[model samples]
Target: MRGSTNRNTRRVRGVLGAAIVVCAVTTALPGAASADPAGVARTAGAEVGTGVGVERVSVAPDGTQSDGGSTGGAITTDGRRIVFSSSATNIAPGNAAGSERVYLRDEPSGQLKSVGSYPIASPVISGDGEYAAYWVLLFRDTKVKLAQWTAGSSIGLNCDALNCSQPSLSGDGRYVANVATIGRPSTSQRIDVWDWHANTKQELAWFDHTAPSRPSISGDGRFVAYQNGRTKDVFLWDRDHGSTSGPIEGAAKEATLVQISEDGSKLVYLSGTDTYVHDVSTGTAHLVPNVKGLAIDPTGNHLLYAPNDTAGPSLKLRDLTAGTDEIVSNQPASAGVDAVSAGGRDVVFQSTADDIVPGDTNGKSDVFVRRFS
Candidate 1:
C-alpha cells in the first residue's frame, strides 16, 4: 500500500488540524493467483508479539496551520477523535517541519496524540474508539502498529507481515486482515488474520500474484474482501465457514475496497472511474452510477463520489438503498473522500478548491467533513 498511496477522507476544521494523515491504498489489474480454499493446513499460530514500547507525544493544533498538506483517514464512533497524516510541523508534537507524521485529533480532550511515522496506508480507527491500526516501514520491511488510546500505549506488531499492504481491523480491534509474504525470497503471499482476542495469527489463503491493496475486513471481522495482487480481481473470504469466494469476475483493474459490513451483506469497491456495489439483499452487482467514488457507509446504503463529465469535481452522494443522488459540493479543483463516520452520517475529504468553505483562502489543499441527516 505504501509504494505510492493516494489518501482520502475527513475534513479540516481550523485549517492545520492535528489529525492523523494516512495514505489511501490503491490497486491495478493483476494475473491469476494460486489459491487453496482448503488450505487451513498452512495455518500458523503464535502468541501476539508486543514489540518495543513507545509513549505517544502530544501536541495541540487546532484551526491555525498547513505549510504542507494533510490527509484524514479514520474517525471514531462519536466523531470526537480523528487520525490523519500531515507534513506541517506545528500540528504534531516532536515532528520536524515538513517531516510527514500521523496525529490524532482528540476534540473532546483538546489534544493531539502522535501515532508515529508516515504509515504505508491510512490507519483505521475502531468503532469503540479504543484502538488504531496501521503499518509503517520499520526497518527491513513494513510492520503494523497498534495504538491503544485508553491505555495510552503504542505497540509495534512484533509479527512479520504476510505482506506489507495495509491492514484492516474490526470495530473492536479484535481481528486484523492483511496479506503477507509467506516465504522468504519468493513472491508468494497469503492472506493472514491476526486475532487480538485469541492472540494468534491465522493463514486464510496462500497464493501468488497478490497486489498491495488492503484486505478489507468486515466490521465484526467475519468477512474479508481483497483484490488479487496479480489479477486485480476482487475476492471475498468468509472466516466462520473457512471458504473463499471471488476474483469477483469483472472487477477490472484499479480499486479501493471499503470495509465490508459485519453481516457481509453489503460490499463496495471503488475503482478508477468505477463504483462496484454488490448488494446481496438485492442480488445485483450494481455498477456505473458515479465516477471516482470515494467512501461507502458501513451499511452500504450510501456512496460518496465525483460526477463524470463535470467542470469541477461535483462531490455527490448516492443513497444506495433508495437509488437517489445528491450533490455535496462543487469545488473547482480535485478532491477525494477520506473517512466516513459511523452509519455513514458524516464524511471528510481533501480538496484544493478554496472557495467551498468560508475564509479558506490559503490556496492549498484542505480537509473538510460533510454531514448528512
Candidate 2:
C-alpha cells in the first residue's frame, strides 16, 4: 500500500554528507538469456535445506559504539558481501545518538568496514554486484538524498528538493527508483525513478490519497513493484511509458510486504496470512505452492514468508516450478522474513530466529545465509 506523507515521528537528523573513495573489483551476473533451468537446479543441488543456514550478522549494542546496533541491511546478488547500517565506533562520524550510519561487511574476509557515516538506510545492491544505493537523510533537513556506492566512492545524486525514501537499484546499476513525497502531511506520495546514466528523473504515477512507497526494481531495470494504501495493493511501474500496471491477484487491501521478480514479469505480495504470487504478464495470482513469507527470491523462483499455523513466523521456501514447498528452519518463534537474494546457487535472507543462534538472541534481528545443497 502507499505510504502516508504524514510524519509518523518528529523529524530528526544529524550529519549532512561525506564522500570517500577507495578501489575494488567489479563483478557482474550472467545474462538472463543464457540462464539454464536444469543447470540452475543442479547447481542449487538436491540438499537445498541441509547446508542452508542463517547468520546473525548485526545487532544492537548496550552503548553508542561504532557497530553498536543494527538498523537495516542488504546483500549482494552473489551473497558475498553485506551492506548495512550500524552505530559502531570503528566506523566513523561516531555515534549520532539515535541516528544510524552505513557499514559494509565482506563475508569471505569477515571484515566489517564503515562505508558511510551518515544517517543512511534501505541499502540495496544492484544485480551486477558492481554498485549499491541507499537513502540518506541530510542532517537536520527534511529532504532525503539518494547516494550511490561504487568501486569505493559515495556520490549524491541530484534529486532537487523533493523528499524521498526507500531506494531500489536495478541489476545493471543504471536505474534507481524511490518513493517521493510532495507537499506536506496531506501531500501526495508518488514513485520517482532516476536513470543515473542519463541523469534524468521522471514521476511514474500517483496513488490518489494513497502514497506509493517501498519500491523494488527488476534486474533489467524495466519494472518497479511497490505497495499502495493499506490494502497491500502492489503496482508495477513501467519505466518505458511512466505508467503503473495492476494491484496483482489475490492481493487484499491488507497486504503488507511486496516484492517483484528480477525479470519484472512476476509480482509477489502477502495476502492475509498467505503469500500470493502473480504473473504480471497474464495478471494471474496463485498461492505459491507452499511458501508463506512476504519476500521473494531475485529470480522469482522461490518465495519466503511467515506461516500462520506455526508458532513463530518460520522461513518457508516455495519452489515455483515444482509446485512444492519446504520449511528451511524448524524454529517455532520467528519474526517476518525481510528479504531473499538468490542467483548464484545461494539464497540468503534477513530474519529473527532465536533457536538458530544461542544466547545472542536479544530480540534484535540478524542476517542469515543458506546455500542450496
Candidate 3:
C-alpha cells in the first residue's frame, strides 16, 4: 500500500459556493487553438528521439498535492500548463477532511492560480485547449458532482443524487465521460457519457459488482478505456457502435491495466507481469518485451515503461511499429517511476530521485520532462 491511496468516500460540499464565486466573476479571454498548422507534426517529431526531456514541475512537501491523498494532474497538448493537486496547505495531516482543490500553474508565465475553492479531483484538460473538467464533492450530503469550465463559463453537469467520479473530456471539448454509482458498494455502478453540446446523458454500461476507475476517452472521442473489477482487468467501450471489446482476448485476467492510443486505434494494457498492446483495429495482442510500467506515447507507435530491475525504474521507450526499444533515462539506483505524459516531441514522467527530503520516505514522486532524443 506504499504507493496506493484509497478513493475518497467522504464528500465535501463547498462546490456550490465555489460555483457561485466563479460565475459572478467576469470570463477570461477564450483560449485560442494552436495557430500552428504543424502542431501535431511537432509533437510527433519528438517521439522519435531517445526519450522526451524530463523536468521536475512539482515535488511533495513543496506545495505539491493530490486529491484524497492520491496524485492527479493535467498536462496540456502544448505543455505550457500543468494543473495538479497538493496537500501542502489547508488540510490537516492524516485527515482527508481538509479538502483537495484544483490549482494551475502556467509554465511560461509562472503564474499559479486556484480554480475557485471547491474540493476538486482528477483534473483533465480538453484536446482543443478550450475546456477543463473535474469532480467536485459537496460536503453537505457527501455527494460527488461533475463540473466543467470553458474559457468563458463554468457549469455543473448534473448529478442529482448519484456519486460520480473520473471525468474525461473529448478532444473537441464537446463530451464528458464518467462513472456514476447509484448505491455505492451494495448497488451496481454504471458508466455514463454526457454530450455537452446536446445537453443530454446516456448510460454507457453497467457493472454488476465491480466499479470502474480511471475512465479515459480517446482524442477523437471514439473510445473509452477503464479498469474493471477485482481482477484488475481493463476494458474498452466503443462509442460509435455502443459495444464492449476486451477484457481483450489474451490480456491477463487479474493483472491488466489499459491505456488507449490518442488516435483510439490501439489498446495498451498490462498483462500478468508484462505489458501488452492490442490493436483495436485488428484485435491482435503483442507483448512489449522487457518493458514495465508501460505508458504509451500519444501517437500509439511508441510505448514508455519501466524496466524489470528494482534499482529504481528507468524510462524505456519502444517503437511498437518498428519492433525496437531503448532506455531513455537511467536515474540513480534510488529513483522509481511514477507517471508519464507523452505529447508531440516531448515526454514527461514522475520519478523519485535520491535528492528527495530525508524522512519523507513515503516514496514521494517528482515530475521530469525529457525531449525524447
What tens-digit string does per-residue lDDT give for candidate 2 at 149-231?
44456656555435667777787777777766665553766666677666667666555543446787888888877776554
CA shift at 175, candidate 1, in angstroms?
A: 1.0
The predictions' CA RMSDs to the true structure, in order, are 15.7, 9.2, 9.9
- Model 1, residue 166: displacement in angstroms? 0.9
Best by lDDT: 1
**Candidate numbers, best TM-score first, in rank order:** 1, 2, 3
Per-residue lDDT tens digits for candidate 3, residues 1-373, read 1111112222221222123334212212112111021112122212212223343444322233222332354555555555555443422233245445554545543334445345555466665445666666665323333333334345565643357777776766676767767664437565666665666665655665544566777877778777665546666777677676656643435545546766777777765568888788888878765556445655577677777765753666677777775555566321111123443344444445533222223354444345443
**Candidate 1's C-alpha lDDT?**
0.56
Q: Of the candidates numbered 1 and 3, which has the greater TM-score value?
A: 1
Query: What overall lDDT goes with each candidate model?
Result: 0.56, 0.54, 0.51
Residue 333 displacement (Å), model 3: 12
Best by TM-score: 1
